[model samples]
Target chain A: MDFERLYRDHADTVFGYLAFKLQDRQIAEDLVQETFLAAYHGLEQLEGVQSPKAWLLAIAHNKLVDFLRRSRNQDLPLHPESLEAASSSAPSKLHMQEILEQLAEPERTIVYGLYVEGLTCRELGEILGLPEGTVKSKAHYARRRLYQWLQEGSAV
Target chain B: MSSEEYKELAWGLVYGTLSAEERELALHLVSQDPEFLEALKMELELKQRLAHLKRAMPEEAKERVYAAITGSRSQVLVTAVLKTVLETTLPRMLWPVLQILERSVFAGEQQ
Candidate 1:
């Protein structure tokens, strides 16, 4: 199924989502491997899939959820301060991270999928297992929150 | 439409999730309603800022994924070749040496 081409196309997307969510490049890289390996095994199923990027992202989202669950079970800090050192030092990236930190899950994932990954609401709905309407509402709320925050930040 | 619904439509417009009829409604509101116009403008700005967060996967990570998928096969091939060399060629090559050693041991014992 030309798995290499698939990976080449979506590796950044999968990694970006993981890195953004986990805030740890090393762990994100590990999960990227897991996601693609899982995809590799499921290559036959991918033939009829409509959007390969969204499909890969769904796998990535599940991997992240599993990792977070395992982490919670182990009592590991989900967002380690030390991991921030591993992220980009650019101001815009730091700012973006600061803004995203204010959001909770599903909203965070939706906003990221819609704005950053450029996925449609329907695609995000499929990935997040929520109805399209729910995704749109969450996106609306998240955008308003971000707008308010941006206005406040600018005021300051 | 309610302000909340317009807000949702504003976001839908920005994300390109709006249908033809919904998009028509959104644009009509944009022209007629100042609040909806402001909301649409904010959404566009927010979209741009959020898009700035997009990051490329590191080269090392990409290489690692490639290696992980291919490395297992390469490892198996290498193991099989080494096993064949050790089991077939090594034993065959060492048989004459073993015979020479055996004769030397017997000669020494007889002496």
Candidate 2:
């Protein structure tokens, strides 16, 4: 795989996923670097890999999980306010973030991955280590909840 | 099919994850069931709205990744400069020479 091209294509997506999950720009940025660096090292294996974006995102997800685990052990603050602070000037983003915040884990990630990142259910299943049927079900429930909330105008 | 089954199929349809048979079933449900149609509409709308929430990686963060990949900030800067030269300045500078060479080749062919 052409590493530079892959980075150009999916860096924003990987970074966005990390930033959304971590809620901290600096940590997300660090993780982005690490993710790409790991991809760079694994370039040979990436040959013939379909859906490089999903592959990079799976790596990013792993990185986020590791960061979360380490943070818990180290007592590091994830800086949830960072997302708020970053999006303070953009109400639409802040509003979206608020709505996303209302979702539970894995579902929140599933919704963001499927809708925002445009990842396939199979890709999400691979990334989240769940069966495709389970990913679809989670996505179904998450979408329904979001739809009901939006319809009620409660999340607006 | 159960309501849950129909909803799962609807989700599969939204994500394009359904097999041919599953899709046919979902479409059949969409035609026959008003509730299924409504759910599909809402799901599609939610997908559209959520798509708009995509975030761009900040320029600084992108630079960090580039630097990390390329080894250092200075290396990235140098690579960027070299790429610009190769893509733009060098091509323009060599254009006259290339034109002259082409003309010479044409003249030789004529002779």
Candidate 3:
């Protein structure tokens, strides 16, 4: 399945998503490996999937959710930097790096893939194994969520 | 266009997360709706800010990962085994021994 090419072409986005979503470098790296491994193995079985990008994303998303549920059940100690970012009055100065640093795990993956990776809705749908419709909807939802969070930054 | 819906579609479109049609529709809606136009500007700004956040994987790690995936460890192992076996083979070694024996017999007879 040329998994290496896939990993080379998409690994950064995948890792970025995982790192942001999982909030742990180690776990994110593990999930990235698992995601590629799943792609390596699952390529043979993915007949009905119309969008491969979305399909992969769906697998990755599920992996993320499973990891989150199994692990990270406890409320984490708040990062002081995020707390400080939240308190700063100059919201416009908020950089993408700061946003990424402050972002909780799931949102990080979705946002990084969409905005930073520059993946389209259809591409996301293919990666996640979702209908293009569903991918678009989720992306829309993700955007709104980001907007809400950005608004909350000033309040912090 | 509802402000909420505009907020959603606007960000999605600028982020490159929306389909081509949705982006067109969002733009159309923004043009027609006064409030949505304002929200669209904010969405655009947010997108610009987030655009700067894009990052690349570390170069060395990227190469290492590629090797891990595509490296032909088995091929190398098999080739090494074949070379070793050829060096140790019966007929291949016997050829050198026969050459040595031929030289001794011919050495004394050579005028």
Per prediction, fnat is: 0.63, 0.69, 0.37
Give Cα-based local distance difference scores for all models.
0.81, 0.78, 0.62
Best-to-worst ranking by DockQ: 1, 2, 3
lDDT for B73 in candidate 1 is 51
lDDT of 2 by residue, B5-44 (tens): 6655676798887899989988888889998897787667
User: Where's the lowest-lDDT run of ten residues in candidate 2 chain B?
Assistant: B2-11
- The whole-model C-alpha lDDT of candidate 2 against the native structure comes to 0.78
Candidate 2: docking tier: acceptable
Candidate 3, residues A1-156, lDDT tens digits: the string is 355556667777666666545445556666766776677667675566565555666677778877767666775442324223223345554554565556554345556666666666566655555677876666566666667766676413
**Candidate 1 wrongly placed segments (more than 4 Å):** A75-96, A153-156, B2-33, B73-111
True contacts kept of 3: 0.37
In model 2, the runs with Cα more than 4 Å from the true position are A88-96, B1-33, B72-111
TM-score of chain A of each: 0.85, 0.89, 0.57
Q: Candidates ranked by lDDT, best first?
A: 1, 2, 3
Q: What is candidate 3's TM-score against the reference?
A: 0.56
Candidate 1 chain B least-lDDT 10 residues = B82-91
Give DockQ for candidates 1 onward, in order: 0.36, 0.35, 0.19
lDDT of 2 by residue, A46-81 (tens): 866777887788888888889889989999977767
Clashes in model 2: which pairs? none
Chain A in model 3: its TM-score?
A: 0.57
Which lDDT tens digits does candidate 1 get at residues B1-111? Answer: 777677678878987878999999998988899989988887787777777567678898799777997676577579679757766766587878866876897799799
- After aligning candidate 2 to the native by TM-score, how far in Å is the CA of B100 from where it should be? 58
